[model samples]
Target: MEENKREVQVTLVESILIMIGMFAILGALIIGAEMPPQIPILLVFTLLMFYGRLRHVTWDQIFAGIIEGIKPGIIPIMIFLMIGLLVSSWLRSGTIATIMVIGFKILSAQFFLLTVFLICCLIGITVGSSFTTISTMGIAFMGIGHILGFSAAITAGAIVSGAFFGNNMSPLSDTSNLTTGLTKVNLYDHLKNMAITAIPSALITLGLFFILGRTSSTADLTQTQQISQQLQRSFNVSIWALLPILVLLLLAWRQVPAIPTLLVGSLTALVVILVSSPGYSVSQIGTLLMNGNAAKTGSHTVDRLMSGGGINNMLGSVSLIIVALALGGLLIQYGVVHTLITSIKQYVNTPGKLILLNMLSGIGVNFLVGEQYLSIILPGTTFMSSYDRLGLPRKYLTRTLASGGADVNALVPWGVSGVFIAGTLGVNPLAYVPLAFYAYIDPIITILFGFTLVTWRYRRSGKRPATSTATTSVGLKDRDQPVN
Candidate 1:
C-alpha cells in the first residue's frame, strides 16, 4: 500500500540548501551559459520538485502548491495581456505614432542628452513601458547622439535612466502594477510613496545629463526629420490620436481597476482605428489584436518602433510568472521561505534594517537570477512578514522592490533588461552602467529614507505586537518576534 504523508516543515539547513542550489543553477545557466531566464527558471522549478519529492511531498500536494503560488499572479498576468492589446491597438490607431512625432519635433541638439532623457521619460510614461520606449525613442536618440558626436555610452545611459524613471512611476507600468499587486498595496498609493525617492533621483539624473550633454557642434537634423517623416507618413499624427490615452488617464485617475481600465483603453483605440481607417477589415483588426501591428513604414527604425504588442507577445511573461510563482509556492509550501525568514528575523530588527535587507536581497537576486521579475517576487515574498510585524505598511515594500529590483535590472550585464537595452542601443551594457544614474540613485535614496525614517508610515496604533501569527495558503504560519 502507498503511504500518505503530511506536509513537513523544512529546516533551516534544508532551506539554505535549496537557496544555494537555486542560486547555483540559475547563475550557471542564466549567467554562465547566457540562456534566457525562462529555461533557468524552469530548471530551478524542477530542482525544487525533486527536493520536494525526497521530502515525501505527493504530486497532488505539489500541484496544489503550484496553484496556490499562481493565484496571486493571475491578476497580473491578465493585466500584462491587456497591456499587450492596448499597445497594439494604440499603435494601429496612430496613438503611439502621434506621440513619437510630437517628441521628435521638440528635440534640440544644444541640450541633446537632456532632451533625450526628457523625451524618453515622456514616451515611457505615456506608454507605461520601458522596453517600448527604449526600443523606439531610445534607438532614435542613439542615432542622433552618434551624429552629434556624443559618447554612445552616455547617451545609452540617459535613455535607460529616463525610460526606467517613467516606468517606475507610471500607473500603467506592468512592473509597478506587479509590485503593488504582490504587496497588496493600492496602486496610486504605491506610486505616491515611490515619488518620495523617484522625484529626487530624476532631478539628479537630469542635472547630470545636462552637464554631460554640453556639445558645441551644430548637428544636421536629417536623421530626425527622416524618422519623423516616416512616422507621419505611416500613421495619422493628429490631436485626435490622443483621445484613447486621455481616456486611460482619466480612468486611472478615478482609481478604476487596472484590467478594466486597460480594456476600455484598447476598445477606445479600436473605435478610433475603425473610424479613421474605414478600409481596415475586421479580420485585419483581429490580426492586429492577436499578432500585433505588421505594416512597415519603409524605414527600418520606424518599422522597429511600430512593430510590437498583441496578446501573443505577453505569453512569455505570462509563462514566466506562472512558473516562478509555482516555485515560490513550493518554497512556501515546503516551509523553505518560513525557515529562512525565521532564521533572518532576529537580524532585521528595525524598519531600516528590514528595508536594507530587502533591497540587498532584491539586488542579489537580480545579479544571481538575471531576471527582474524574480528579483521582485522572491524578496517581496520573503520580507512581507517583516514589513507587517514592524507596523510598516506594505507600500514601502512595493517602493523598495521597484528601487532594488525592477530599476536595477537594466544595469546588470547579464540581466534581461540589460541585454535588451545593450542590443537595441548598440552599446555595451557595462559601459552605460556609470551613466544610468537613476537606477542606483533610487535605491540609495530609499535606503537613506529607511535609516532616517523619512516618509515612513506606520500603523494607526504606531505600536506593533511582539508577535503575530498568520496562516495562509502559502503557509506563512511562523510568528515574527521583532527585536526591541
Candidate 2:
C-alpha cells in the first residue's frame, strides 16, 4: 500500500512539473522584457515549484541530483575555462590582432569579396565559433558584400549557414562539446557521425552561394581598395602570430583534452603577445584576460569587431548554463523527466518511431523556448530513457540532438542564434529562414536515417529480419548489445 501511494504521489508531481514546463516555454516565447524569460522559466518558477513539490526528497537527495547533473557538465565547463584562458592569451599574443590586419588587407582587392563567403565557412570550421567568426570575418564579409552590391540578407545567410555548420561539427565548438558530454560520447565520434549529414548539406550551400556570387554585381573598386587599405593600416599583420592558431589546431588534431589544449594554446599565445605587443607588461596582460581585449585600434568598426572573449564576456552564458542545469536536476528529482519519457516511450517502441519522436521533440522545444541550450538539455534528458529502452546507443541520441536540436534554432526567427544573426547581418531573420540549407537538412536527414534503419547496430539474438520493423521486448541498448 505504501509503495503504491508513493507511486501515486510521484505521478502527481510529474504532472504539475510538466504543466510548469509548458508555461515556461510559453512565457519565454511571448515575454519581451529586457531580460530573457528563460531565467524565470528555469530558476524562479520551475525550480521553486520543483523544490516545493519534492517534500519527500531530502536536502541530501536534492543536492545529489544537482551534483549529478553538474558533474556531467564538468567537461564542457572545463573547456569553457580553458577557452577563457586561451582567448586571453591569444589576445595578449597578438594572434587576433594579426588576423584582423591580414583580413583587412584581403578586403581591399576586387575578387576577394566573392571569396569572403567561402572563407568565412572555412574559418567557421576551424574556430568552431559562429559568433566569433561572424564578428571577425563576417563583418569584413559584410563590408566587402556592400561594396560588391550583394544584398545584406543573402550575405548574412551565407555567413550564418557556414559558421553554424562548423559549430555543429567542430570538435572544438562549445555546443558540439556540450552535446557529446551530455550523451557520454567521444567528441570525435560525434563529429564523424555528423559528417553523414553535414557534408552533403555544405556542398549544396556552397553551390547555391557560388550561383549567388555570380549573379551579384561587383562593388566600386576604389571603395573596396580603400576599405582594405584602412584594415591593413589598423593592425600589424604578421605570419608569425598565426603560429598559435596552428598550434591550437595541432592539439585538436591529436585529440588532446580540451582543457589542456586550450591552456597550452593560451599560454603559447601569451608568449607571442610579448613578442608582438611590447606596449603592455605581464600585469596588463592579466587585466586584459579578465576584462577581455580592449581594442585600441582607433577605428570604431575595427574596435567593435575585435574586442571580446574575456572571462567577463562569458559570464552571461555561464550563469544561464548553471541555472538551466539546476532546473534540469530539479525536473529529474520531481519525476517530470521520467514521466514524460515513459509516456512517450509507450507510443514509440520502434527504432524509427523513437528517432522521429526525439527529433520532433527537440525541434518543437527549440521553437517554443527560443533558446538553443534548453532545446538540447530538456529534450535530451526527456528522451534518454527511450533510447536506452530501444537498444539505441546514447551516441545516436546525442547525434540526433545535434542534428535536430543544436542548430535548429537557426530556423526560428526569434531563437537566440536567429536573433543574433539577424541583428548582426542587418537583415530580417524571417527573410533568410528558407535559405538556411543546413538548418533544414539536419532534422530531415535524422528522420530519414530513423525510418531507413541505415547504419543501425543491433544485438545478436534480438536482431529483427531485414524486412521487419516490429517492436521488441528484448530491450535495446545503443546501436547493438542487449540491455544489461
Candidate 3:
C-alpha cells in the first residue's frame, strides 16, 4: 500500500494564501482583462509549481502530483468527446430539430421558459449530459426566447438549472457516475438521495421562471415558422427523425454505460441521416460526422444553433479539464490542499461544518481551477478520511460533491462549463449567473440542510454503518443509519 512518494509539509496559512492568490489572479484576468481562462490557469500552475519547489518538494513529486490528480478525469474527457459527436450526429439526423419543432408547437410564448426548463430536465436525464442538452435544446430555447422578447440570460438560466438537474441525477451522466465511483457509492442510490433536495429546488426554479415568464411578449410565429421550414428544407424532419433520441432514452433507461450509449446514438443518427437525406453520398456523411454539420438554412439563428458538433468542438473544454486537473494534482500531491483542509479541522468540526466546508471547497475549486471535474474529485478525495472518521455516511459526501461540484461550475463566468455554455447558447456567462437558479441554489440548500441536519445521515456512534466494511470502500452501504 505504500509506494512511497515524498510528502511535503505545508502550513495552512500558506495553503490558504496560495488558493487566494491563484483565484485572485484568475478573477482579475477574467473580470479585468477578459483574457481566455487558459492563460491565467497556465500562469497559476506555473506559479504553484514554483511555490511547491520553494517549499522543498522535489521535481518528480511535482510532476507526479499533477498526473495523479488528472487520472480520474480521463474517462470524463472521453465521454465529453462522445457528447460532441452525439450532438452533431443528432443535429444531422434532425432529431433535435424535430424536438424543437414539437416544442414550439406545444409551447405558448407565455409559458416557454417553464417548458424549456421541464423539457431540458427530461432530455437532460435522458441524455445525461448538460453540455449536450444546452448545446442542442438550450440553443433552440435561447433563439425562440430572444424572438419572444424574453431575456436570453433568464432562458439560459432555466436551461442551466434543468440540464444540471439531470446531470446530477441521471444514472448515465459522467459526473453522476464519477461521483459515485469516486466515493464508492451505488449510482441508483445516489440518484435517490439527490432527489431529497433536487426536486424541491427544481420546483422552486420552475415557479420562479413561471412568474418571470409572464413578462415575456408573444413571440412572432414567423421566427418559429422560419426555423421549422428551414428544418424541413435542410433535413427530413419526420417522426422517423425521433429514432436516435428514442434510442438514447431507451439505452439510458436500461442502464447502459455512457460511452457505448453515445456510440449507439451516433450510429443511430448516421443511419437516420443516410436513409432520410436523398442521395447523400457516403463520403459526405463521413465528413459531416468529423467536421460537424454546417447548417446553411438561410436563417442566421437556425444556422447558428444547428451548425455545431463533432469532436473538434469539444477540444477546448477537454483541454481546460486536463489543465485544471493537473493543477488539482499539484495541490493534492504536494500537500497544499491537505494543509488547508487540516487547518480547517478546528473550525469545521461538526457534520454541518463539514458540509459547509465541502460546499465551499468544491466551489472554491471551481473558481480557482475553473472546472467541475476538479471540483468533485478534489473534495471527494480530500475529505474521504474525514467523513470516514466522523462516521458520516458517504452518501452525504457524494451528495455534497454533486451539489457543490457538478452544479456549481457553470455559475462562474471563467469556469470550463461556463465558457462552453456561453459559447454554445450565445449568452454571457456572468449575466446568466444569477439566473442559473438551480445551480446556485443546490449548494446553498445543501449547506442549510447541514446546519439543521435535515435529510442527512448524521453520525451516531463514530463508526461506519454495519453494512459498510472497512475494506469495502465509501458510500457502498445498503442504507444510511440515521442519527439520534
Candidate 4:
C-alpha cells in the first residue's frame, strides 16, 4: 500500500497482453518444444524488467518488489533442501525400502492407487506439507507404481491429490493457515466452511482413484517381490526403519517448525543407519547427505526407483521457486496484478457473479503471479471491500481463496506448486494435472456451492450491517441452517 517511489503506468490491456504472451510462449517451449521451464520463465522475467524500464521505473524499486515477493519463498526453498536430505537419508536408512516392502504385501494391487491417495492425504494433513509428503512417501509410491505396472502420470496424480488434500484441509498446513490469517477468518470456522465443498470433492476424487486403480493395476507381483527382496538385501527393512516417519509425525503434532523437524528426521535416519549397518562409515553417510542416495543393487528397477534424494537433487526446484518468486515481486511492484483485477471488478455486480468473480480472481492471480500465497492475499484483499458491502462472513472469502487459488497452484504447469511438485516427484506437472483430481475439483465445487447456497452467514441475526471496513461475526453455520 506504500506509494511507489517510481511507477510504470501500464494499461490493463497491456498487462493482459504481456501475460498471455508469456504464457503462450512458456507453453510452447515447455510442452510443444519439450524444453525445460526455467528458460521460458526467465525470459518472461526479462521481458517484465524491460517493460518496467520502459515506464521509467527505477532499478531499485523494481528490484525491491522482487526481493519482497521472493521473501516468502525462502523457507520453502530451505525446506526443499531438507527434503533432499530427508529422502536421501531415509533411503539410506531403509525407511523408504521398508514402506515399499510392507506396502506391496498388505495393500491389494487393485487398491494400490487409492491407498497412495489416502496415505498421502493422511501424511499431508499430519505433516502439513505436500512437498515433504511427496519427497518421502510419494517417492516410495512411484517405485510401487512401477512394480504394479500402473501409469506414472496417474500415480503421480494420486499422490498429488492426496498431498494437496491434506495440505488444504489440515490446520497445521502453512497455506491453510495463510488463507485464514489473511482473510481474518477464524481458522476453525474457515475449515468448517470448506467442508461442504472439500468433503464432496474428496469423495468424488477418492471414487475416481478407486476406479482408476481397479482398471490400471496389472499386479506384477514378480516385480514387487523382486523389489522387496532387493530392498531387504540392500538395507535393514524393519519396523525400526519406520521410526523416522514417526519422529516426523510427532514433530508436526507438536508444532515444531518444518526445517528443524526435517533436520531432526534426517539426522535421526543417519543415526539409525549407523546403528543398523555397522559398515556404513561417516564418509559414506557424508556422501549420501551431499549427493543423495545411489542404489547399485544390481536390479535396475530398484536402482531407478530408490535412486532419488539429497541436497543436490532439490537444487533445481529451489532455483525455479526463487526465480518465480522474483517474478512475482516484480509484478507486485509494478501493480500490474492489482490493476488487472480491479478492471474486472466492475462487471461483478450480483452476489452470484461476485462469488464467481472472486473464484476467477484467485485463479487469475494464480496464473499471473505464479505463487500460491499471493493468490490468497491478492484476491482476498481485493474483494474484502465488496464482501463487506454484501455483509458476507469473512470465512467465505478465506474458503474461496484457498480452494480457488491455493489449491489451483499445483495444477498450473509453470506455477510454483506445479514446478516444485513435478521436479520433486519426477513427473511432469502437465501430465499429472488431469489426474490431480483434488486440485482442480476444489475450485469447481467452491464456486458451484457459492452460487447454489449460502457458504457462511454471521451467526447472530444474520446482519453485520454493511460497511466498507470490518464486519461483525455472530458465528457461522452451513447453507441450510438459518443465520441464528
The 10-residue segment of model 4 with minimum total lDDT is 473-482
Q: Write the per-residue lDDT of candidate 2 for residues 1-484, one digit (tens) a residue.
A: 2232234225755555665665566456535443553456454535444544455665555665566545544554555545556665655455665664555555543344346656766776776766656554565566456555667777777777778887777767777887877867777777887787777777777777667666665556665455455555654456877887788667756666556766777777777777767776878887877877676667665555455556776555455445545555555555555565456655776777877878877776565444567668777877776666555666677778887776797776545566556544546666777766667776787778767644354433364423124333423323433222
Candidate 4 residue spans exceeding 4 A from truth: 1-6, 455-484
Q: How accurate locally is residue 211 in candidate 2, as Cα lDDT from 0 to 100? A: 71
Candidate 1 clashes between residue pairs 3 or more apart in a chain or in different chains: none
What tens digits encode model 3's per-residue C-alpha lDDT throughout 36-117?
Answer: 7678887899998998888777888888887886787677678778877877888888887887777768888878888889
The per-prediction CA RMSD against the true structure, in angstroms, equals: 6.6, 6.5, 3.9, 3.0
TM-score result, candidate 1: 0.72
The reply for model 3, stretches above 4 Å from the true place, is 1-4, 171-190, 216-218, 370-374, 381-392, 413-416, 453-479
Candidate that beats the other on lDDT, 2 or 4, i.e. the better one = 4
- Check candidate 3 and list the clashing pairs: none
lDDT of 1 by residue, 62-180 (tens): 87777766776676667667877887888788887886677667766668889888877886777787876775567556655755657789889999999999999888888998898
Each candidate structure's TM-score, on Cα atoms with residue i matched to residue i, is 0.72, 0.69, 0.87, 0.93
Q: What's the lDDT for residue 31 in model 1?
A: 65
User: What order do you get sorting by TM-score, best first?
Assistant: 4, 3, 1, 2
Candidate 3 similarity to native, TM-score? 0.87
State the displacement of the C-alpha of residue 393, model 4, in Å, after optimal TM-score superposition.
0.5
Measure candidate 2: CA RMSD.
Answer: 6.5
